[model samples]
Each structure stands twice: as C-alpha cells, then as structure tokens.
Target: MTDLFSSVALPGGFEEVEHTADWAYHIWAPDYVHLFLQAARGLYALLGAEWSPEPGTTRRVKLQGVDYESLLIAWLNELLFYRYGENLGFNQIDITHLAPTCLEATLGGSPITQWSKDIKAATYHNLAITPTDDGVEATIVLDV
Candidate 1:
C-alpha cells in the first residue's frame, strides 16, 4: 500500500501528509489538529490555483479548522467566500489534515455560472472526532 503521509495526486493537483501520529499517546488532540491545518495550508500553497471570478467554474481550496463542524464550515465558507466574494464555484475537496477535532484540506473546481442550490447558513451538525490507531479520524457533518 502507499504511504499515508506521502504526497499523492489529488483531484485538484497534489498533496502530501505533513505530519501524522506515530502510534503514541498525547495530551490533547488540538495540538495535532494544528499540524493538520498547517499541512493542508501547505498543499493549497503548492496548488497555486487562485480564486477565479468566473461563472460555473470550480476552483481549488485550502482551509483549516479545529473541530468537525468548524472544519466543515470552513470548507463551505471558503466556497462561499469564493462564490460571494469572487463569484466562483467549489467542487472537489482534498482533505490532508485528518484529525479528530481539526482538518486541513484543499478543494478544487466550482462552477461560477451556476448559482448555489440553496442559500443556507453554516450550522453544527453534531460533529465529532476520535483518535484511532492510524492517527486521528473524524466525520464532519455540515448543516447546510
């Protein structure tokens, strides 16, 4: 199998794992969450796909967070930022920061022409993150 932390080609472009748990213990999960954010930010920088002010055009994204809901919100917010701020669309998301309460990721491709399906605010969908043997894992629920 391929290395989990190694750089891999994503839907947007490419991504690499900046850090991961080494099967050890830790005090709080937030510290690790920060690492994931940093990594994801790095990836976004590498992609070099800026916000395009087009209609129905998908663009790549790089956003970070400290919790599931926050992470999801951050992801969609970035899309919203592109949409309202620059009139762009968001499509695929490449999540490199896999943490229980944090996330770092890069997204690609959003339509600028197509209007948002619904204008809904971000909400906490009772998100949760948990530690696992392979590092950290969590499922973010977005109230859209």
Candidate 2:
C-alpha cells in the first residue's frame, strides 16, 4: 500500500523526481516521454499490477501522444499495459512538474482478471509538441 506519487526513478536510471503535478499541465520536453513512461510503470507496479497482455481477450488499448497529452497518455498507456497485458488496473493518478526542467507523474490503476490486445507497446503517431502555461507540453497519440 504505497502512494503512487512517492519519489521514484525514471527510465535511463534517472536520479530521482518529485512525482507531483498541478491541476493544469504545460508542454514538456520531448525526451521526457520515456522518463514519464518509466515513472508510470513504477506507479502501476507499486500499485500491484502486471505489464503484459492477458490470457484470452479481444480488446486493444490505444494511446495518442498530443501536446500535454504525453503526460496523461504515458500514464494511461502504462495502465493499459496493466489492464490488457497483466489484467490489472488502478484507480487514481497524480502527475506533477516539480523542477522547471522536470516532468514527473504518478498514476494508479485497478487490477482485473480480464482484457485482450495484441499491442506490444505505445506508439508516437501524429505526435506534436506545443506550449502550455507551466512550460512546454506535447501531444502524443499512441496505438495500443
């Protein structure tokens, strides 16, 4: 029973981040996507979920990376990974941009025993970045 937003390490062995976010978000850098994904995975795993597809089902999850959408998409895609892949889900997600040069996120999904999909991973189709209130955000449309 750990808080999903607890400090965690991102991908590429990032040092550490304050996985907290405000109600509104802004466009972040491009390289932050993978880092966000790693954080989302940590949140999903910490909440007790799987990271693969289910045994038998016919459902697919799609994620579209859009401006400021990457933050939400990254989190949802990870949840989709749990739901479709591991049959697990979360309930809540908390994201944040701690440092002016940092983009951290926290997500929670519920665990279930059902789901279906052939999606191997998230896609960056029609992706575009834009400016936002906080900083720089982008739109990432993913295909589950």
Candidate 3:
C-alpha cells in the first residue's frame, strides 16, 4: 500500500496528518483550482482506491456552498457519493469554475476495482482554506 503520509511532488500536493480518530491530510496547491483537485486526489489516496482498466466515464458537477470551507466539504462529499453510491473512482478532475461559494467541474474516472478503506464523509471539523506563500492550503478531516 502507498504510505498515506508520504510527501508528494509539489506545485500542488498532499500529505497525511496525524488524527486521533478518523483520517486527515493537509492539501495545498498553487491556487483554488489545483487545491480542489489535490484534495480529490488525497481523498482517493486515503481510500487506497484504484480504477478499472476499461474506458473511463465522466460526470459534470455543479455545487454551491455558504463559503469556501462549505464548498470544499460539498465538493469532497459529492465525490464520496459517487464512490459509494455509484462505485466510481475518479482520477481526472477539471474545475472549470470556482468561487467563494460555488464550483463547477468535470470529473473523469472508471469503475472502482479496489478500495481498502471506507470514508464516511469529509468533515468540516476545523476545516479552513487559507492563503500561503505560493498558493492555498487546507486541513481536511474525513469521517471513517
């Protein structure tokens, strides 16, 4: 299994964080778009999810939230819905539009062939997207 806490090649990346219960990671990217994308990838990593070799599938997503934090949670939870409800795992994500309270994206993936963990939801527990020297970062906690 890939180490959940290993450092990833940068520009945009994620690394696991120690949490007493549930799971958590710190994600960062050069901007909101990449930040969102990295978060999706991080979630999949935590699940140890893998996709099928067949032709990929795609979906369009449009979401709105009260703020960036809520929007982030909604975005991740939407992915979780697809995973458990549809048995899908995405490896391609294109965020065409993003704002303080809304997001639009195209997601591409295939049927999930493997998943080692069950993450119930992406929590808002101490969640916040903040600016950094190069981009933005957030600490995401997932309910397992």
Candidate 4:
C-alpha cells in the first residue's frame, strides 16, 4: 500500500495514515539512527505533546531486543513509558548505535505538563523496516 511518505526523500520524516481504529504512522530516515529518531518524534506528534522551552537533562538509554523490529518497538515504548511514567517530552535525540538487536542513545528534552493524547503501547502489527534509495523506512501502529 502506498502512503504519503512512500516516496519521500533522504533525511526522511513521518506521516499519519488512515486507519479504521488505532493510529498508524509511516516514518523514514536516511539511516538507522535517524529512522529511530524520526519514529520517536512521530510518536510524540501523535500524542500532541507540548514541551517546555528548557531542554531536559541528557540521559543515556541502552536497550536490547531480539531484532531490529523488536528494538524499534522497545525504543518507542521506552519513550512512551517516559512520558507516562516520568512526564518527559524528548527532543534532540542522538543514537550512537542501532544494531540489529540493541541501541544506545543520548536524548535531550524537557518534562511535559500536558499532552492531548497518550498511547497504550508500541505494537508490532505490520511493523517492517526496509532499506530505500534514501535510507530506511517503517510503519508503526500504536494502540491509542
């Protein structure tokens, strides 16, 4: 199926797609690090997150999964958990490595006081990350 982002260029981004029930997002980037960052931003955009002007303290995040898909899901879910559990709104993320089964990142952002929406989890439904001329792309389905 074609999406608004299906033919996007290098240094990619995300777009909302039509779905019967849950929210879906199509995201892409020029590389794995950018792909992960874009996915996080897309998920935050879906939440209608509002942020503070002061950037949050830099924090190290180390995650291990069974594969790239699992890593993606875990990475996104970890961000969501921060929002739900710590009230953070991340920005300026830097991923040092996003190997097939693990990722290490340093993120910067601030605490959130309010957000319009929240997600239940980062799902695996139809999740696939593939290489493109510009870079890698993936679609994420979230439980809202």
Candidate 5:
C-alpha cells in the first residue's frame, strides 16, 4: 500500500524492531500529537492495511488513560477495533485535543480492502513513552 503519511512533513518517524514473537516498533515525534500520529501510521503499516476506492469515512474518537503508555495503547487499540470489528482502515487522523491523560481526534479512511497481518491488540510489554532530545519516543509491542 502507499505510504499514508508521505505528503505531510513531520518530525520523527517509526521503524520496525526485532521481536522474538509478536511485533514491535520504535516511534518518535516532536511532541505528543505528532507522536500519536506516527504511532497510528506505524500500526496501519504493520497491518499491511489497504483502503477501498470509495469515498472515505470519518469518525471522532475520544479516549482517556492514567498515563502516556495507557493512553497510547488505548489509541492504537481503538484503531485496531475499527480495522478488525468495523472493517475500516484510516490514513488520515487529526488529533484535536490531547492532554496527559485524554485525547480526542478525527479519523478518516475507507473500508479495508486488504490486510496481510492479524494484530490482536497493542501490548504494554516494555512500553514506555520517553522524552528525547527532539521530542518523545516509545517502543510499542503488539500482541499477534
């Protein structure tokens, strides 16, 4: 599939990491909003997700967590829900509001036409969002 975030110029990015089992990615961005966006893009890439040609669908998402890690997992799992349960894949995401424990965003995409991998859920194994010289970074592990 095409690179979803190719047109946008953003600081930081994500890369797949070696894992004995399951999947993992190291994601970084200049701030929380960009970090979240990168995480979503990474998740979609990992799924090998593809969208239909039909007009895209849009939905609003709201989530809360006790910390950054939980909030990040919640965000990714929410996207997974749309992918598996709703048969949707999003390429466009706009996070309108974000705080230490809450997030609200608008997601845009179309019905999923292809998915090569099955991701059960985002996991907390060794999950931690940390501050970096440029912004923030985290290594996300997924349950396959």
Candidate 6:
C-alpha cells in the first residue's frame, strides 16, 4: 500500500499549499484520528503561534454534523474559537471517539501569544476527505 502511494503523487505529510485568497493546507495521516490532529497542528503552524512552556490547560471538544467534512470544519472552528477567544493553542490532542458525523477530543496545550497572522475560520471550499490505501487525505481551506 505504501508502495502504491510512492508511485503516485500523494501528500504523505502535512504542508501548506498556495491559494488564491485564503490559507490552505494539504494533510494526510495513518488514520482519521491522526488526520484531525495533524490538521490542528497545521493550523497552528500557519498562524505562527508560539505556545507557553507550561503544560497549559486541557479542554474537551465535541462537534456534530452531517458528515466527516462538516464535522472536520466544525471541530477546527472550535479550535479557532479557542485561539481567538481564550488565546489558547493545543499541542497535544487525544481523540476519544470519532465517527463519520461526530467526534470527541481532549486537547492539551497552553496559552499562546505573538502570532504572525490571524485565521478567521475554516472554510468548506474544496474540502474533501479522501481515503487512501493506508489512511486518509484532505485539503483544508481557511478564511483569513
């Protein structure tokens, strides 16, 4: 399966891609759990956010929607709310439950300051979660 991806053009890791008017990310991981976690990490990296050394605080997050893509947007938007509302950024995430239309996660991280940029929200533009032989891949576009 890995060899199949090697012969094909595929995103095996997280990276930022060029977009016309918004920030976008290409991300893939070994499973849905890691996929979402990487998405969160990518968002933080795009913001150039600096985290405090403290272990920070932990929070429970839940998002329910009609499908995986919708849930993904909502989950990321919740994280964005945490960033703008509480000045928080998560460095670690534990997905306790994940389904096609719902998810529950425990995020552990710290307060952040001095970001180079601001992200308004995650958008559904070109949002697609495609399954791979070994995992899943998706492109996330953020409204900046």
Residue 129 of model 5 has an lDDT of 92
Among residues 3 or more apart in sequence or in different chains, the pairs in candidate 5 whose N, CA or C atoms overlap within 3 Å are: none
Error of 4 at 10 (Å): 9.1
The TM-score obtained by model 3 is: 0.91
TM-scores for every candidate against the unseen true structure: 0.40, 0.34, 0.91, 0.88, 0.95, 0.88
Model 2 agreement with the true structure over 1-144: per-residue lDDT tens digits? 223334662323212222232111122433455435433444344334433333322323333443444545554555556656556554344444433333344544444543333334444554444444533444333332
**Per-prediction count of colliding residue pairs?**
17, 29, 0, 1, 0, 0
lDDT of 3 by residue, 28-94 (tens): 9998877888888899989999778989788999999999889999999999999999999878777
TM-score of 1: 0.40
Stretches of candidate 5 exceeding 4 Å from the true structure:
1-4
Give me the overall lDDT of model 1: 0.41
**2 against 4, candidate with superior lDDT:** 4
Sort all candidates by TM-score, best to worst: 5, 3, 4, 6, 1, 2
Model 3 lDDT vs. the true structure?
A: 0.87
* Ten-residue region with minimum lDDT total, candidate 5: 1-10
Better of 1 and 6 by lDDT: 6
| CA lDDT scores, all candidates in order | 0.41, 0.41, 0.87, 0.82, 0.89, 0.82
| lDDT string, candidate 4, 51-96, tens digits | 8776556678999999999999999999998888888877667787
Tens digits of per-residue lDDT, candidate 5, 34-98, equal 89988998999899987799998899999999988899999999999998789998887888999
Error of 4 at 32 (Å): 1.0
Please give the lDDT score at residue 124 for candidate 4: 97
**Judged by lDDT against the true structure, how good is candidate 4?**
0.82
Count of clashes in candidate 6: 0
Top candidate when judged by TM-score against the true structure: 5
The segments of candidate 4 whose C-alpha lies over 4 angstroms from its true place after superposition are: 1-10
**Model 4: lowest-lDDT 10 consecutive positions:** 1-10
lDDT, residue 25, candidate 1: 13
